[model samples]
Target chain A: MISIDWYLALSAILFCIGIVGVLIRKNAIVIFMCVELMLNAVNLSLVSFSSHYGNVDGQILVFFSLAIAAAEAVVGLAIIIAIFRNNFSVDITQINLLRW
Target chain B: MITYSFIFLAVLAVATALGLVISKNTVNSALFLVLNMVSLSGVYLLLQAQFLAIIQILVYAGAIMVLFLFVIMLLNIDEEESLFNKFRIKYFVAFLLGVGIFAQLIYSIGSFSDTLPVVSAQMAEAGTVEAIGDVLYTKYSLPFHIIAMLLTAAVNGALLVAQHKTKPLTEEND
Candidate 1:
């Protein structure tokens, strides 16, 4: 039987990669993809724990997370598209009008 | 067999994730993210979340990714260059932080073992659609309805925000 620690480790590594990508990547969309990666990592952990405990709560929670993720994607992409229309670029470094 | 499958899926997930982050072209990155999502769904299957596995593929790989692709193509943004130029201090800091976080997590969780009671066979059935539906509709019905409302609002909000320039304000002023 695969251990829970294995899953946990994998999730942790994936989450850190997402964080790194968020920090290093310049494209707004790629940053957004990294955020999705972080969410997926959390979902993996949640499922692993749910299975470990033999409870349905974790899976149900996953359902809610997935729903929220989808909603977030729509709003986020709309914002990105809006920004692209005005700025003509999705590079975070370039779209710094709000930077103080 | 499960361990082997886990290793395979995990490697695929991590590889595609890295590719998504590093690929220069946005379209290529998007495709890599799709591969990552599919591999994650496979991992979900290994975890016995049959329903979730299917939903992951449908919602994430299908709907969400299509939305990403549409915006990506619609924007027609070009590839960014010199992403790894002169070693900025921030990049170093970010890498350090990532490594620190990973080390901390691994150190903390290394000794931990599963203590939860093994799921009873019947309770394990809860991973199925029918079982989840029973709980979702009964105990979590209010939140479910709320999520439905939220989705509708998101759709309307996206439409409003993304609508093309409706005859510039200057035309109205004239």
Candidate 2:
């Protein structure tokens, strides 16, 4: 009963929340979670479009994206941990060694 | 029928997202993210992409998040306090960017009604796993390989980043 439009709207709102998380949170771990949220939002839209058209390719693509997300989370979390250890804090503001 | 459930899931998803943003406890945030992912899996099911829904649950809700929990627990994150400030401008700019993207998507969807029917007719198959495998193997082989390579890259990159160097730079013992 949920129209494709409704699905799209839900995804849009979720995507916006993810964007806000990425923007407002300074913790790298939180930021990474937001990135995952964004990916999930896109996945929702992809499945909706695939179903709307009856195409399976879009659904398949979600698998690939999920794999990439896993890799990203693993890599990102590691870097954050390493950064935390090096700096003794995950406060993001204190770990500004790379910034110009 | 499903619209009611859709609204329900939407509420759950938003609530968890708020938790993810505001929760001071890292483990709590991770748990909220799991809740969010589970609701997203429900969204996929509603879309009729059964395969994708399962993957969303298994990979995202199950595996990746457990990994997050492990790190949070192993590191024992809570005893330390997180510092609070200096990025107000960054947050405002990112909010504006999100609004811009949403506006453009709404505009495009509104303006392009004519192409909808054709797109729908083409996608009418409600993509099955077999159908996807066939198309990806036949029509989109190169992109598939590229995606594969990217996954490999991300995995390798992550593993490399995670490695901790125990050896000291001074090497006095050696």
lDDT of 1 by residue, B50-157 (tens): 899999999999999999998888888646675532448869988999999999988887777756533335445878899899999999999999999999999988
**Candidate 1's residue-wise lDDT over A58-95, tens digit each?**
98999999999999999999889888888888888776
How well is each residue in A63-83 modelled by candidate 2, as lDDT tens digits? 778987887787788887788
Worst 10 residues of 2 chain A by lDDT: A1-10
Evaluate model 2: give its TM-score.
0.84
Q: Please report, as a residue range, the 10-residue window in candidate 2 chain B with the lowest summed lDDT.
A: B112-121
Itemize residue pairs with steric clashes in candidate 1: none
Show pairs that collide, candidate 2.
A53-B123, A53-B124, A54-B123, A54-B124, A54-B125, A54-B126, A54-B127, A55-B127, A56-B127
| TM-scores, all models, native as reference | 0.92, 0.84
lDDT scores of the candidates, listed in order: 0.86, 0.76
Off by over 4 Å in 1: B84-87, B115-123, B166-174
